[model samples]
Target: YNVTHVPYNGLAPALTGIRDGSVQACMLPYTALVKNLNGKDLRVLAVQSKARLPWLPDVPTTGQQGYPEMDGNDSFVNIAAPKGTPEAVIAKLEGALQKTMQDAGVRKKLEELEVQTMFMGSRETQKWLEDDVRKFSTIIRDAGLSTK
Candidate 1:
């Protein structure tokens, strides 16, 4: 499949372009599209995630359209400190994160994206990242792919 990639400076411009019909189409994370979706001026052709998003139950996933292996469901925002940051600093950051996640508004917005705000401490986050690296590494090797 061939596609054209249009790079926008930020979400505002990209969204404006979509709203004004400057671009024929664009793809973005579903959560990013949620607040504006109900307006009806824009339409969601397909979701990139494996399952249909709760906020957009009517839309089909890319996998459902035919590519069953296409499963890019989730996005994450992580907080990381410098390599030698002290434990107290990490604890403070984690505490703040936990508090933010507890907010009803934030939690509602996150659920719309189908994102579960994970407040894994640095250690657990590191372990998860490491495991992901190994898992993707194996997949890339099997597919004969490389960043290079």
Candidate 2:
């Protein structure tokens, strides 16, 4: 498919483009699409995560839709401190975040926003970042997109 990459200034314009039929589809964040999902105007074709989202139970993942390469394309929230931050500070932050994520109210709110929260400690997060860099860097190199 000759997909056109339309660059909008922000979410409002992009959403407007979708709402008024200026665009057929878009890759928007789950949080951004939650409220719009109420009407029949918009639909979620496939989630980019490796597994299907609990909030979108009926929808399939990109991998299931025959695009396994897109499975790693996930929107995530991370809390990072400056470099050389004390290990105790990192541990405390991680513990608090883990606890907050496990809270019923917080979990419910995130779920309502179609965001599935997964807590990854610093080590795991670092591994994920490194892996993501390797993955996307290869794609960029293959596509000949240079930093210049």
Candidate 3:
């Protein structure tokens, strides 16, 4: 299939194009389309995840939809600080973040926004970031993408 790429400035315009029939479809983050999906303005054919999102439990994952290769693109939210930040400050921040994640109201709000909260300590987050960089580096090379 010959595909033409049409870039939009942001999620709003891309979603507007889809709604106004200027574009047929788009691959966007579930959070970006959560409101539209709930409002019945759009339909999701499949999610590009290994498992269905909790917010869109009925939607099939790419793997379940016969596109297992499309999985492994999950995004995450992490907190970072300057390289020279003190370890005590880092621990305090991580503790506060984890506590916030445990709060019922915070979790509910995050769920409403279609965000999954996964709190990790400093060491775990460092490992996760390193792994993600290595994984995406391989993916970029395989896809012939270049920073230049």
Top candidate when judged by lDDT against the true structure: 2
Model 2 Cα shift for residue 29 (angstroms): 1.0
Alpha-carbon local distance difference test for all models: 0.75, 0.86, 0.82
Q: Work out the TM-score per prediction.
A: 0.62, 0.85, 0.79
The lDDT-based order of candidates, best leading, equals 2, 3, 1
How does model 2 score by TM-score? 0.85
Report the Cα lDDT for candidate 3. Answer: 0.82
The candidate that wins on TM-score is 2
Clashes of each: 0, 0, 0
Colliding residue pairs in candidate 1: none
> Mind giving the per-residue lDDT tens digits that candidate 2 earns over 98-124?
999899999988777667788999999
Q: Report residue 143 deviation for candidate 1 (angstroms).
A: 14
| CA error at residue 25 for candidate 2, angstroms | 1.8
Residue 136 Cα positional deviation in candidate 3, in Å, after optimal superposition:
3.0
Candidate 1 backbone overlaps, count? 0
Tens digit of per-residue lDDT, candidate 3, span 2-41: 5455788888999999999998888887777777884599
User: Which candidate do you rate higher for lDDT, 1 or 3?
Assistant: 3
Q: Which consecutive 10 residues in model 2 have the weakest lDDT in total?
A: 139-148
